[model samples]
Target: MDSSAGHTPEPGSPDEPVVVLGVVAAPGQAIGLARKLVEADLTDHIQTTFPGARWQLELLEAGVVQPPAGDAEIVDATRDLLLEHEWDLVLCLTDLPLHVGKRPVVAHANAVHGVAVLSVPALGATGVRQRARGIITGLVGQLLGADADDLREHQKSPARSALRHRVRQLGTDVDEAGTAFTARVLTGNLRLLTGMVRANRPWRLALGLSRALTGAIAAGVFALVTADIWLLADTFGGIRLTGVALGSIIAITATLIIGADLWERGSSRQTREQVALFNIVTVITVVLGVAAFYAALFVLSAIGALCLVVPQVFGATLDHPAGFTDYLEVAWLTCSLATVGGALGAGLETDEAVRDAAYTQHPAEPI
Candidate 1:
């Protein structure tokens, strides 16, 4: 692929000593972060720490290439990017959750090659743009020949703590492969999980399931008009209603996972652990998607019940005075029933469609 085929290059002076930094990022969140890096003008920030040379950013979106699995592979890919572009240094950002041994890797830098690979998900779900900017600045500073201590001292107060705490540099051997930075153990895993889910963007799953939403709305509307449903809603206790809600959500979540074959099955030990991590991320993504659907159904159901069902008629049927709680109960029951209908409707969707909607990117491994 041509290095400068699509993206516009950041403007800079050719006469000045310019350091062109090429940013190759995986599609989705990683690409967005890369764009933000350009908009933020990290070159200006880098100048504050390293000083002297003008810096320019060149971005390449790498959606077609599969994410590199290991540090060596990542370095190789960065080197390839460097060869393709006239970049003084390269940074490859991927949404993939990278692991070095048992720990989650945040980023890796090779001074000799003038390249770095950053795992975006390891930065977690919140304040991603800020964290990315900070980390990138530090890594770019390092690539520009600024020592860690000098970079640390020059970094803004806000980003200093983040650089110190979030990134722990490892591997002392001064080889071409360079040093690895990893997140702390317990908090790192938590961040990885949340970050993976954020990358998946569970809300999109609801938007993708058009057939399911139709079925859910149909069921919810039918339940709203049914006298039996109204009576049951009035009589069922809060605990019973809660149980029903939980059951329906679980049923739908499981249905999508099973029906679409989203569950990962791996053979080797390392692969198994990776599979488990993917599975957990999948489950959480589905659950959140289902829950969002349920919430929408409940809101619509409640409105329908309030507008369609007369208060006096509902009171007469239940043999008690109708109140706001009655409307809520009706909505709650309708949501539960609608969810089950949605699960049934989910069967109409193709496995590929579900998989595409549910994942940020397809893994190189089989799902």
Candidate 2:
């Protein structure tokens, strides 16, 4: 698909309500995917949500941007970005997580201004294309006060939204919204939270680990064959052993994150902030998954070594006693070796998989 499609709109009638939906996705393949996803679904979503009015909803790639801190700031920023353009509605969809007070907000909108911004994370395990379409359409119905009765029946009231006693508005505060549709803009309820949690899948962690899988495995095998397992066990004993295990995981995860293709074409601070946050989250999730895999591999490698290699053959040359010490020693050596392997795997990882692994918002800044 042409990258230009995201920025340009098709000619339309002046009488129709022109809603320019600005999707700010991560740079590169993800942005392209975002554009395609929005273009294919925006028209149907608007029509389904609002039925009657003649509409000209255009999906624009609003470049790359990190969502601002506060809900009010986000609304103002979204409105300001589209002020130059005559728009009936401006919806900015970002990968950055948004929050109101301590609770996570799915989406935020200023109905009076006809502007809304939603977090991609809030969509939770829903496909990017489907969830993006739903949220944007829902926000449109929300901002215009169209299909209120139909939407409300399907949606929960603000009272039932908060997991805690205080039901804080997820989008814009009720008093500030200035609409009778007042029941809290996209009520941040239990259902929303459930979807968000479901969206944070473990497969993402696997993707990170996959980046270095081959190298990690090769290195483990090589280390088992050559490294002095007995000495390694003696050096990294008890609590210190845990540190070695954790270090291996961190090293591999960091390699994938640093080497992964996450650069956006935007030079803005918001772009940089979004990219930084994305990297942090990706690295952490990868670490959790990779660590578990590495530990299991280490144990299996140790068992294989103990069953195959006679400790007595190297006992005389060993600095430490063999016994059960050999098993811990071999495991530590193999784990450390796997990290080196991870580095090699990082280089071989595909561009598609890397982009799929990270949360996308927009394109990279031109060098």
Clash totals in order: 0, 18
> How would you encode candidate 2's per-residue C-alpha lDDT over 1-367 as one tens digit per residue?
1112123222343322223344445455446656776667666655544432334555565534453445545554665564444344567766677654356677754443446676666667647666666666666654443233435643454223221111111111122222322222223232432232223343444444475777777877777766455456556667776776667666666666566643322233222222222233444445555665676677777776777656776465465446776666766667766766776786678654553443222211101
Q: After superposition, how far is residue 300 of candidate 2 from its true place, in Å?
A: 2.7
User: Which lDDT tens digits does candidate 1 get at residues 1-367?
Assistant: 0112233233353433445678898888888888887777666665554443455678999842464455555655665566556455688888776653346667755543456778888888998777777777666654433444444554555234322221211101111211221112223335445655765678878788887888888888888899999999888989999999999999889879999877755443222223344566788889998888888888888888889999999999999899999999998999999988898888888775676567543111100
Q: Which residue pairs clash in candidate 1? A: none
Task: Estimate candidate 2's alpha-carbon lDDT, on a 0 to 1 scale.
Answer: 0.50
Global lDDT scores for all candidate models: 0.66, 0.50
The 10-residue segment of model 1 with minimum total lDDT is 169-178
In Å, residue 348's CA in model 1 sits off its true spot by 1.7
